[model samples]
Target chain A: MTEALLHVDAIETFYGPIQAIRGVSLEVAPHQIVTVLGANGAGKTTVLRTVSGILDPEAGKVVFEGKDIAHMAPDQVMRMGICHVPEGREVFPFLTVRENLMMGSYTRRDSDGIAKDLALCFRYFPRLEERQHQRAGLLSGGEQQMLAISRALMGKPKLLLLDEPSLGLSPILVQQIFEIIRRINQEQGVAILLVEQNAHIALKTADYGYVLEVGRIVAEDHCATLLGRDDIKEFYLGQKEAGVRGQRRWKKRRLWN
Target chain B: MEDAARLLQLVVNGAAAGCIYGLIALGFVLIYKATEMVNFAQGDIMMLGGFVAYSAIAHWGVNYWVGGLIAIAATAAFGYALDAIVLRRVIGQPQFAVVMLTLGLGFIFRAAAGITWGYDSVGFDTPFTNKTVKLGGLILGDDNLSIIAGTVLLCGVLYLFFAKTRLGVAMQASSQNQLAAYYMGIPVRNVFSMIWAISAGVAAVAGILLSPVSMIDVNMGFLGIKAFAAAVIGGFGSIPGSVIGGVFVGIVEQLAGYYLPAGFQEVTSNIVLLGMLFIRPQGLFAERMGKRV
Candidate 1:
């Protein structure tokens, strides 16, 4: 494809003695929304951590913007325009929401451009503007998620790595979040590599998808094809109405006929 | 009227002494805020700073101010070197080990100073000799007045440094959340190193300032115990609190020494320190973070 913004080639990461990610290879093209769909403990978070340079990989390469940033420190990687919105939304609890957003642009020197982006963030999430002076820790769960995204946007990254943005949100809020993600993708021209356990929603939003199971990509295809596949239906998209796995498989085949 | 004048004199002396305590407390707060390590060796470091200035003035034939500047720079470099060599290795390990290591460092620094300067205390002469100002039939020494003025100037400069600069904000961010700061591209290690140097530099300034009032000795390192009390009084992380706490501690001690029995005077300050710990706990100005609702 059209010059991958982030290229991950067979990267393995270890936490002390335990190998969390084993030769995981992935890629996100410029301005594309790519989702890594997996269950919990499938090494999705580890992959993001490795690519973002929080944890160094034992082997393989992470090329961002054609630079080999495989073993670079997190700060150096962030300087190269890869912003990772980590799991649990680790927003600074003591800092004001405005201060948290300001911290996101810590590496940047363009004051005027940063101010403009901040205004754009307030436009994107008006709720943030209302609570601009409030401590980030006090924001509601959904609002905190919005603030995290807005803070990441403040970094003005070429690539955004999000780990389970829908983790603790209600269905309604999840839908709202997905819509905001869609807007961010379409408007910002920023590439997104989303790692999520919510496969149904992830497939709907992503242009391309990779199905991860036990630290390996079991399948990779266009999101529409993945959504349409019989195997995916059996494993992830089993219909609630069918109430039985085998029956749904037979029903899906019969429906096509 | 004579008793009131004596009391006034004690208060002024106490304030001057409190400025020194405040400077010591400020050093503790700076390093503690940046790294969460107490730097128990701070008093020894201050003593070391004084010795550096003493050597510079005596051997190098430097002016007292120039010697003071050189001493601050040298001690700052020493602090940075200590961080790089000793402190960096023990970081992310058991905090007790780090604490004990710093305590050991203090002893080592004191022992080194003792070897170099000998066991005897030495005078650190001020640029201004003992002069007096009279006001309403009361007298104020130039040294005491300068001590107050100097303390205010240092505090003001530090306040502006932390408030107006980008590096200061980055240091603040690092202190708040080291991991988040690192992830955000802030060089947290550099910030820690800078903080250690700054703390040492502040200690050097205190040492140089106090050298005029009191003779410099290895025993002066014990004054860190009192400064630690000052840090507690000010609310450990608060800069202004450190200064106020130091002054408060100094004044209380002076008043107790004057009013109470002769034997109780020496440890009277620790009683106020104990009261502060039991009553307020967080000091006057520290922000308490409750559970996030």
Candidate 2:
């Protein structure tokens, strides 16, 4: 593997007595869009949390840009160019949209560069420019997602780990959000590690995909290959099951015995 | 004419007292903004400030002005140490736990002061001139006038600090969202420690200033309760609000004592407090940034 931009090795995480992710290993290659597809409670969000240092791994290592950052603080991780847009888009509600954007560049001191980056954000979402002075809490779900993405962009991250970007979005907005993700990956050359529940769309957009079931990677393959596979199609890709395919899906095969 | 002059004197005296209460309330606000914990020990911390100055001036023979500065520094150091050793351990704890811990701390400080200074009340000599100024047949003590002027100066300085300085903005941001502030690379833990230090320092100044008016005693810490009332009258997090609240409480209390029946004065002060709360639950000048979530 050509030195991945972000690498995780056999990481385990827990919430008190309950083990969340057990020996989860994953990687995202430089400038590649990698998707981790899993059901709810499959530890998808936990993986991002561990890498971003919101949740520390009980075991294993997280390597970012050739540095071991398994135990680094969240801000320190961000400083090292890894921005996590957490699930639910936890925007500072009382702050103005402009103030929320300003907070994203809190670590930066270059006034000219910050101003330029802000202009760039407004260009990406003209809606943000119009609602710049309005409080962030008043924005619609789609607009908030745009602000979240733009806020992360202000951090100038080398890799963006997004959790459930399409969770509460409408279908049209979901498609638009995925398209924006693709454009960000292409135009900004920033690698993305996306964890999503919208399987069909995620599979379509991702360059490579990991099928995680119960905190373990059940399969890893090129997105096209995964999408075409008979077993994966029935299990995740929403293809019709059984009669025509006779695919030996693991869950079905196990049930027959 | 004599009665009118006396009324003017009482107003001036209450204003001076109100300024000190405002300064103390400022300390309360500073700590509350940073930690979201009410430091019940603020009064004891102020009492400790007075004792520190007393020891410096009496034993070390330091100039009174220099001794006052030393007291502030000593109290700040003590506050920092308290944060590092005691408060830091219980951070992110439940609100009740934090409140009880600080209350216990306040008691410990009071006990320590009792052990060291004994039960006797002692007078504090200040550097400010004690001349009485004549105005419209009323005499205002130079000390009282100085207290008012000093309070205005301190508020102005703090206003500039909060509005203009980078550190002040960072501190304000930290108060707004600590997790976000940490993620933004602000040293939040350090900010917490600094806030406590500054609070203790402010409390010490109030203690020293008040000592020349009312003799230093263990009972002085109870003034924190009145200061708490002041803070509530003004918005809790607002600097200007606290000052105005303190002065309003002080003047109202004085006016009630003079104009109302003997038993009614105490009841009237509380009545004013309740009236303010019933009308504006968030206080008259709180920032309108409250959120449902």
Candidate 3:
């Protein structure tokens, strides 16, 4: 893609002393859905955090809209139109749903635009509107997830960093959420860098995909191409041949060598 | 009939005293809710506010109303600077260090105030001074009544600010989830400083309202100890609960002072505090919650 919206150039991040993301580079073109597929502790969330400025990379650049934003404060990155919806749907439990949504537009002063966006969020998640006055802590897990997405949308972000959107949801709910995410990207032109462990669905929803294995990128391809790869089908999709089920073995690395 | 009238007078006076404690407790609650640091200097801040108002009114010859407002604004700015210049650096420090820092700050404030305002207890005359209002055969000091009325009015304004205004909601969001608030483009550090300013401003208001009833002295900040009791009784984090707890302590103290021995009144609040801890340590309106994951 020409002129990417978010470009991560070999970022290396660490938690205390242990390196989490080592020499990982990727890009998301404007309005494109980019997914990072990995197992637990594969540094998927670390990549997203690095982009959103929650965890500053020890090295390399995170360039957004042609501006280098590595090591910037999270609020500054957010003000530059990059909103991050962290994992676990961290809603303000003490605040009502409406108040939580109001926080999304805290950086903006245009009341009319905020009100319109509020309406747009309610349109996407009707359940949120129904519980607008209730405390956010009272909402169900599914509803909280919906509220988290809608809250991010209210910020009118140019790039959205979403960590594990399909986490802890039924397959049907995941499908519904992903459908709205796709529509949001299509209609509002909000670029997304989604991180997920649910590889079966992540590939179907994203346009481009990156496979991470223990702090490094092992595979990168178009979503359709990644789906057809022999390794992906056998390991990620559980499409094993007869008598090969439940066996965990790796063929020698080929692409990098 | 005389005893009943005396009791009624005592109750009204107790309520007024309770309101002062409530306002001071509010300062503690606001700062604690936002930054999780207990400002042991909260009462000293109020003392400083009172001295400032006294200077503005007495030396500058300003009106009572204007001087009170100036004191509140000045104290609020001081609170903001206190956080920005010093407390912000200790964001990740252990809680015990903050307590020690604030405790040290309180001693410094007292010494500073003593140097500037002198060790003598000072007073200024107000419209409420030496005045009494009669209600149904019960006589009450106008000074005490004004404190109650002012607290109610201030609480109303604060409630509207927190519930209706965008900045107020932003403050709540920052206190609830700092990370999520940052994602929403909130300057969480600035928001925290603002919370400290509000807490200081509230303390200043309490000090000014208290000026007519009590003398403004360097040692007056010791009242903060009682406010701690009020906050604990109120459930430490809740707003309305703090005020209610203050009132309870005030009334009980008044009753104990009149009916029981002289020394018993002084220890009434402490007794109640210990009793509440034994019975329900969470306070009256605590929002006890464990962080989600």
TM-score of 2: 0.86
Question: Which residues of candidate 1, in runs, are more than 4 Å off?
Answer: A170-173, A230-238, A241-257, B290-293
lDDT of 3 by residue, A69-181 (tens): 99899999999999998899999998999999989888888999999999999999999999999999888888999899989988999998888988899989999999999
lDDT tens digits by residue: candidate 2, B4-109:
8888888888888888778888888988877888888888899999998988987788998899899999999999899988898887899899889888988988
Clash list (residue pairs), candidate 2: none
Q: TM-scores of all models?
A: 0.91, 0.86, 0.98
Best by lDDT: 3
Q: Rate the local accuracy (lDDT) of all candidates.
A: 0.86, 0.83, 0.91
TM-score of chain B of each: 0.95, 0.93, 0.98
Per-candidate DockQ versus the true complex?
Answer: 0.54, 0.34, 0.85
Write out the backbone clash pairs for model 3. Answer: none
> Residue B275 in candidate 3 has what lDDT?
99
Q: How many steric clashes between backbone atoms does each model show?
A: 0, 0, 0
